[model samples]
Target: MSTPSPSSSEDVRRTRILSSKLYFDVPPSKVPLIYSSAYNIAFLGMEKLHPFDSSKWGRICQFLVSAGILDKRCIVEPEEASREDLLVVHSEKYLDSLKSSMTVAKIVEVPPVAMLPNCIIQRKVLDPFRKQVGGSVLASKLAKERGWAINVGGGFHHCSAEKGSGFCAFADISLSIHFAFVRLNISRVMIIDLDAHQGNGHELDFAKDRRVYILDMFNSEVYPLDFNARRHIHQKVELLSGTTTDVYLKKLDEALEVAGRMFNPELIVYNAGTDVLDGDPLGCLRISPDGIIKRDEKVFTFARSKGVPILMLTSGGYMKSSARVIADSIINLSTKCLIEMQGEQNTS
Candidate 1:
């Protein structure tokens, strides 16, 4: 078979992105916070085995609603990304590999998942992930239209085009950027990854692509110590395991300043992972709950100052407390006037 030229491949990708239903227009009455109950993963007590809070997405929304920070009726539900959407970034071989129960179990790090049939695994785990991928993809469009958006799920940054790792089954971050490139007519994107672990997936995918600038602030001693991928980061801030809240925030401020000087992007994709909390075993950092809130405020403030649209994705947080912290941060953002959770009033 003859290899497709780069231009041909670009044409194919554009076609897939244009034909995708995942980028449907959300109503003005709805807030740009993208979420769906289907974003949560739980079935047969299998979720208990993983260190992650599988139902974190739903719990975050529940907390927001209980606190009256968000109106549940106005939340936008994204369509699940179809196989065609997945093909926009994923290789046919990689998508096919997901069919095996073993491959999925290894990627998600759930040993028992290998024993269950692929069909069950698909419904319970991968389906939820795909829905989050849809949310991530749609968030960029919403952010462009509304100045800001938050996908309560997504940030599967460990999965690249041809691989999945560290509980990331799909490359939602890369998929969203690709969708934005074609559908939104956006050429410049900046990925601000504040996850505890490095976002090696998107880093590798955009390694040679100058259109995307990455500012990755992650613990240097964590799960995905990908030195090769580290080279791709336009601005890399590596922190020690026991780095405190003050130190983390200081580094973030400096990084954002430098990033602002380096790249002028039209959109910012913020991977706001709560795993940086002091108690997180994986993150190992000593950032407090209030610190996470402050960190989010700083990023949003930066985006606002630059007059750039920003989209947030809840990435990797293994603790049960992550949901509460995330909800609190969103509330803080609203209090700071960085985001408006209340839907736009229809004056018509």
Candidate 2:
């Protein structure tokens, strides 16, 4: 049998995807969904001092890839901050600090890993977020051109303008928004942040931008120092602790209605965090795994009804070892949602 050249194999399209952009770091450990069902997946990770090893993310990636959720060919790992791109939302100093912490590993004083071994390595594993900017930039562009598409692992919305927070090292969502406006001819954007924690980072970045409309569903008193009044000067809702899934869903229904009435977005960006699972260490609201599924279904359904594309990003969820399971569940729901939304659209 003759061997196919690597370049020839590279030209093969794996699936009939509505999109072609799922990113993983060079190290498979950096991709959480690689283990689920490796269809429509890509490896974009690197073997740096990534939190991947610490998080058993490599195992998670294997599971997703083995399960056939993440297709391996679309992988795209990268290095360094996007010089001009980082300037869109993050300050030069913060970008420098991010590089310093990962390069020399000497400037990192706050992280639990303290020195964060292999600064260069850390940057490699964390490549997904920056590429997320590119992925979502592509997703949004596709949404504009084809009506729907997706970019997994792009919603690190908790990080702020000045610094990183809640394990989020990059501001993928904000950067993507800027990319859309600057490169994709997009404005009048809407971000529906359902990460279970206030999207304080987004609030700080988009609070004054007239083109962005943010709807946040989070516990008021959570990590990362949120300013409730300013969090959504335009529109904010703080769900209390001990709130059940039913109530949360009802409130979400209402919130979705409000978003529809007020923003009527042409492009919808959803921060679908699975941390809302009752046992999530960082979340205040007690929602179940099934509840998380329902939440995503509703959000995707609503966005589809408006005849728009939803750029879904994975944001905050800190369940340690359960991270893989949590990640799988989120992607599972997300995959199922694409089916449901298409069905709903076809029927309608």
Candidate 3:
């Protein structure tokens, strides 16, 4: 078979995006907060081996609902991403590699997963990830229509189209941008990744693609340490391990200002990971709870000021308290009027 041209590849991706059920029209009564019970990964207590709180997605929603910040009925449930949707970004060989239990075990960094059958691993682990991927893709459409959206379970930033690592098994961020480019008629997209670790996956995927701009503020001392990926970042802010909240926020302010001047984007993808919290083992930064809230508020304020639609993904927070912190930050965003949780009353 002849190798497809770049134009032909683009056409295939566009066709896949158009035919995807992941971008179904959400009802007016539903909020742009996309999530589903399927987004949570828990089975046989295997999730406990990793430091990550596998049930954090569900906990975040529970906190919002109990606090009356969100109505369960108003939350938009996204479909699980089908194989065709995965093909939009992932190669056939890469997708095929996922069928190996050992391949998945390495990606998620849980050794015991290698012992499980591929079928069990697929249902227990990958299904939830694919659901979150779908949510991330749907969030773009909702954000474009509603001015902002949040997917409670996505932000798999360490996974690229051909590889998965750092507990990230899929490139939801890259997939979301591609879907928006084709389905929403968006030409320019900005990714604001403040996850305390380098967003190497999306950076590598969009390295030469001028349509996408990445502004990544991460702990330089942390994991992945992808020097080549760091070269692709349009705006990079590297911080140390013990950096306090004040210094972090100041750097963020300066970075956002520079990003604003450098690129004008039609859409913004905010990877708001709570892993930057003071005690997160993986993130290694010392941003306080209040600081996380302020950071989110600042990003939303920036997007609002620029009149750009924003979609947020809860990325890589590992602590047990991450869920509560994420919930509180979201509540703070609503209090600041950056995002209106009242779906039925929101006119803009």
- Angstrom error of the Cα, residue 284, model 3: value is 0.9
Error of 2 at 175 (Å): 1.0
Query: On residues 282-347, what C-alpha lDDT tens digit does candidate 2 reach at each position?
Result: 676788767777787788788778887676665556565435654465466548755322211123
Model 1 spans with C-alpha error above 4 angstroms: none
Error of 1 at 120 (Å): 0.5
For every model shown, what is its TM-score relative to the native structure? 0.99, 0.71, 0.98
Per-residue alpha-carbon lDDT of candidate 3 for residues 17-92, written as tens digits (9 for 90 to 100): 8899998888888889998999889979999999999999999999999999999999999999999999999999
TM-score of 2: 0.71
Q: In model 2, which regions exceed 4 Å deviation?
A: 1-81, 99-112, 116-129, 228-233, 320-348
Q: Could you report the Cα RMSD, in angstroms, for every candidate shown?
A: 0.8, 11.5, 1.7
> What lDDT does the true structure give each of the candidates?
0.95, 0.58, 0.95
**Pairs of residues at least 3 apart in sequence or in different chains that clash in candidate 3:** none
- Candidate 3 — worst ten consecutive residues by lDDT sum? 339-348
- Whole-structure CA lDDT of model 3: 0.95
lDDT of 3 at 271: 98
Could you say which candidate leads in TM-score?
A: 1
